[model samples]
Target: MAPGKLVLATHNPGKVVELAELLGPHGLEVVSAGSLGLPEPDETETTFIGNARLKALAAATASGLPAISDDSGLCVDGLGGAPGIYSARWAGPGKDFAVAMARVNDELGDKSRTAHFICALCVAWPDGHSEVVEGRVDGTLVWPPRGGNGFGYDPMFLMDGQAQTYGEMTRAEKEADNHRARAFRQLVALLPARPA
Candidate 1:
């Protein structure tokens, strides 16, 4: 059965809002760790799944509730996936994504702009039971950025066939095919069916 209440292991308001919207229809009430005054744990894991599992497990253990966490990033093929795990760190202390985008543009000068966004999600229970899923969306990078709808690298990521960057798309448009949405769908499928 779906948990009546689930803690989302994150301090990002955008993620909390997006996740809440994605999971709401499943009959779950979502709460963020930040809302409960839970401390953020250091993400020492090297892989996306590992980080997600770490965060989810920490929140579940602390709050005594089932928890979900997502670790997502943009990886550039030409850059050999550097900044993969360090995607957020690229934004620096103030979470300045504008600086991050500039760095990406600087690095890719005159080179292949192929890239992809990846999302790994983990759901953990207080007793240690856990499930993980991953999803990705292939795309190319754009210069000068675009729109202001999405957070992070969305302004520069244009999906394979879409003319608009993720930042230019409406919430519904982006959610329709985003890596996070794909991962969340897989997670929902893996969740135990709600009792009748």
Candidate 2:
């Protein structure tokens, strides 16, 4: 039987909101570990899936509930996928995404603008069972970042064949076919359906 409720192992309000939206149609009650006073585990893993599993396992064990976690980042082809796991770190302690975006622009310096956003999702049960999936959206980098809607590097990322950056798109538009949404869809497919 599918779980009636699951814990989302994250503290980011944006992620909580987005994940809740994704999980809602599944009929699962989503609660964040942060709301339950669960400590945020350090992401020691190098890969996105590894980090996601680490977080999911930590939350599942600590809360005695099934937990889902995601680790996502932007990878610039010119930079050799640098700032992959360090995407958040690039924002530094204050989470200054502007500075991070600037760094990305400076690093590129007229090189290949190809880039992509990657998301890894992991669902872990208290009993140690877990499943993981990854999704990516290919795109190119843009300078003089545009719009002010989305967060992180959204303003600078223009998906292939799209004119507007993610930051310029409405939430509904961006959520459609996004990396996180794709990963979540895959995860949802693997979940057992709720008993009617």
Candidate 3:
């Protein structure tokens, strides 16, 4: 794996912190694109992996350093996978997830609530070499939302057979089996080993 500083290609503070925590133990000095003043690129790609790769490569090329990016969203089966790639956009310009959650519940009235969260992670080097991986977790949507811990649609997502929503679980609990962590586990094999 390439060493030295790595750019986390995201402007979302939640994602930046979450990804930084995952990358920290691997001995990489992590910096976020937002922190570096890198403009957020339009996610024109239709697939999660494609968007992840595009963002990663864009940041890597712009900063002349290796970069990592993730494109993730809730895919509700009832919505015909709507708000999948457009998850963030559903939150509107204010990024208000409450509104997004409400919209989901409103649109999904009396429909099957089966859903899944998918995450696609990409690592790109300044030379444009990149690797991407994806992970997912299935769950059901809940009404009125729940918990106050996690960000985005976490409050309304109850994992299969789990009592608590992602928003109700502690950081350690969420990271243990969430889609993002699942993707990170795969990406870890390609990363440099932890510092001795």
TM-score winner among the candidates?
1
Model 1 misplacement above 4 A: 1-3, 193-196
TM for candidate 1 is 0.97
* Local accuracy by lDDT, each model: 0.92, 0.90, 0.91
- Supply the TM-score for candidate 2: 0.95
Per-prediction tally of clashes = 0, 0, 0
lDDT of 3 by residue, 40-124 (tens): 9999999999999999999999999889999999999999997899999999999999999999999999888999999999998
lDDT tens string, model 2, 25-47? 87789999989999999999999
Q: Once superposed on the true structure, which residue ranges of model 3 sit more than 4 Å away at CA?
A: 190-196
lDDT (tens digit, per residue) of candidate 1 on 1-196: 2748989999988899889999898888899999999999999999999999999999999999989999999999878896798999999999999999999999988888999999999999888989999999999999999999989999999999999999999989999989999999898888785321
TM-score ranking from best candidate downward:
1, 3, 2
- lDDT comparing candidate 2 with the true structure: 0.90
